[model samples]
Target chain A: MKKLILLSLIILSVFCSCSIKTPEEYYKEKEKGKYTATISINCETAVKYKNSKRKKSEILNNYKVSYNKGDTVFTALKNACKANKIQFEYTGAGDSVYIEGIDYLYEFDCGKHSGWEYSVNGVFPSVGCNAYKLKNGDVIKWLYTCDLGKDIGAVK
Target chain B: MFKNFNPIALFIYFVYVLFISVFSFNPIILTAGILGAVFYCLFTLEKKSVFKLFGFCAFMFLIITLTNPLFSHNGRTVLFFINDNRVTFEALVYGAVLGLAVIEVLIWFKCFSTIFDSERIIFLFGKISPKTALVLSMTLRFIPNFVSNFKSINTTQRLIGSDSRIKRYLNSFSAVITQSLENSVITSDSMKSRGYGLKGRTFYSRFRFSTRDIVFIIISTVLFALSIIGRTDFVFYPSIDAPSLSGFSIIGCFSFSALSLIPFIYELKEGIRWKYSISKI
Candidate 1:
């Protein structure tokens, strides 16, 4: 009888040792956020007709953009142009942005092509005058001539 | 101590141990069941037989653990090297744990077998059918008798002109099989001649539902019901991750099991007293 009691006590102790917490204790920790806006792209028709030299607006006609965001001027310019549905083809030499299908250019070198150019937040410098961050109102122009290539489709 | 050890109680405890070990993954509950079985075995069985059984279990445990890792490679902790093979500590531990559980379950089963011999069967289940009861009793008796008979026949055949061991073994096997068939036929004929299953069979049992038996049955029934309900309804799957044991549950299990042995304890005590009075004469 004593042995039985002792055995029971031991078993009880073993079970009691496993301390399990309730589920309510786990619900107190998590994170919060919100949804943002979408960006699009546009192209000219001259670049579309296999015409290398034509009016920038004639070649690149349709508009499309890819959404992006970063912490620099080039990133901002890229984002604004992306938001405005303008496509960029390669611009000449140093630092410049081009209208993808349209064969129009925006150069930061002041001597060649020109347009409204400003530093994003007047902070971090731009890479090829293309790295820029988006403010409330920033219209980025992409004017260059080449093929806008394929739209490569949209992402959802 | 002997007076307290009841066959019915022992059987109940045996069942409880078996149930917990198999159904409950809580190591503590399993350990308790194992310990209870070991304690019961030590208290009841002869020392030499217990030692022999323990040694056999140890041998089985070693064999199982050594062979288990070759088949199952799981768990995260590595123990040592064997021929450039890293044996995980978890697999080895699991094998040993399983082996111990098997041994503990067997010990409890043996306890039940000892307590519920032919007489107890006749007492408890006699009313079911005389033929069924007789067949069960005879089967239990025949197992050991058949083995001994087979051994003796083999020896005798070898002593006579048998040529090779294989031939002698085959001869002995055939003889035993033929003899067993003849015995069964004769037994069946005798049973039929005696009107073994004619009409309603009346049963004779020394067992009566005393106050003790009634109490024991009630407690056992409740425990069995609770155990079934707990397992089917309350228990969760992947029990390895589930917490299954608690102080109250363990106590409830142990108490129910102990209650079951009351009838057996009464019988043991009665036996002791009868022996004592007979010795006085």
Candidate 2:
């Protein structure tokens, strides 16, 4: 019981830090359930004009994955990409993960504003995708926002 | 008599120096902070403690600097590739700067902790809030008291010559905890009889603001302002360039040096004054 309290305190401290966004911070309160999320890479419009040689099917256009406890949206995306044999490139090992590319279409490939962004249930989470904890029935859409996330309707 | 200076002035001066040391990452500025701290420690700290501080700081510096380039692959001029990640020249230099900053902050804090005693802390906090002052003073005293109590208990148990060293240590520790609790009860009862935490309580302050204190405070405050102006335009990634002494940065550099050296300067001044006065006599 004492060890459990200590562990929870450590978890709380990790979550409280504002260095980068974590998904658990996106929710109003902690919720427990099995979750399903969908991920897609949308570098098609950007890649089509820029590089015609790269195949559109090379990108993970659509994939669905279920999340367990302590699972994040980034993990879901990672699992989906791995299972489907789609190339997914990300940097950072922990909660501060940055998704840099999907398939052959990497960041700065299309334009200066092009990068990966994620939305859960139509609302973009304020925290990083890696930090966002998944809840039951969470719907995730991973898109390539070409105009600093403005094209994808992300607020931050 | 506290090196013939007011506690408030001394506290404020240390605060300014610590603030600058914590924030500034320029190598030259960090070097100055380290030098000032070393000078002060050489004069003030025991010989053993001074050596220990230097050794510990150097060890930490090397560890922090060496590991940084391995993990962070930032900078343009790659020195060599270790496991495909380029160990850039800029990253190594950046790591050194960070390591130096850490060392500077630690040594400066050591000086601050040694100089400012519980009396000074209580006097500083006692002015505005008496309850907080009492708590602060008690917390400060508790550590030393606990240490001394533990030592005495350990010695007493060892003298009895009963059990093994580990068992004796465990017994002493348990005794120390119980004794400390008992001591607190006795202490509170005595304080109650003496009317601690009562209305209209008067405090005896030994610290007096002299002309030197006023001048010192003013100068330190000015130095702090100047140091901020001399901010280094420093970035550690993609490429590395030494922060050139821009006109504004020069002011900051000078101010930071002066602020950091205040304690050393005071001691030097006092030494000179003593020698000159004796010569006159």
**lDDT for each residue of candidate 2 in B1-281, tens digit (9 for 90 to 100):** 23458888888888788788887778878898899889988987899989998999999999989878776655656565443234567778888889999999899878877777777877788768866877777777788899999998899888989589999999999999999899878977887788766778776778889898999899889989988877885766556666776799888888788888888877887878889999999
How do the residues A1-156 of candidate 2 rate in per-residue lDDT, one tens digit apiece? 999999999988865652432222322223333666666656545645454445553365555676688899887876675455444456787889998776545677667878888888889887887899888667778777668877668854
Candidate 2 local Cα displacement, residue B143, angstroms: 3.2
What TM value does model 2 have?
A: 0.65
List each candidate's DockQ score: 0.01, 0.04
Score residue B122 of candidate 1 by CA lDDT: 58
- Judged by DockQ, which candidate is best? 2
Candidate closest to the true structure, highest lDDT: 2
i-RMSD of all predictions: 24.0, 14.1
Question: Could you give candidate 1's per-residue lDDT for residues A1-48 as a string of tens digits?
Answer: 999999999989875764433222222312121212222222342234
Q: What is the C-alpha lDDT of each candidate?
A: 0.51, 0.75
Model 1, stretches more than 4 Å misplaced? A1-156, B1-17, B46-48, B80-86, B129-131, B157-163, B218-246, B249-281
| RMSD (Å) of each candidate, 1 decimal | 24.6, 11.9
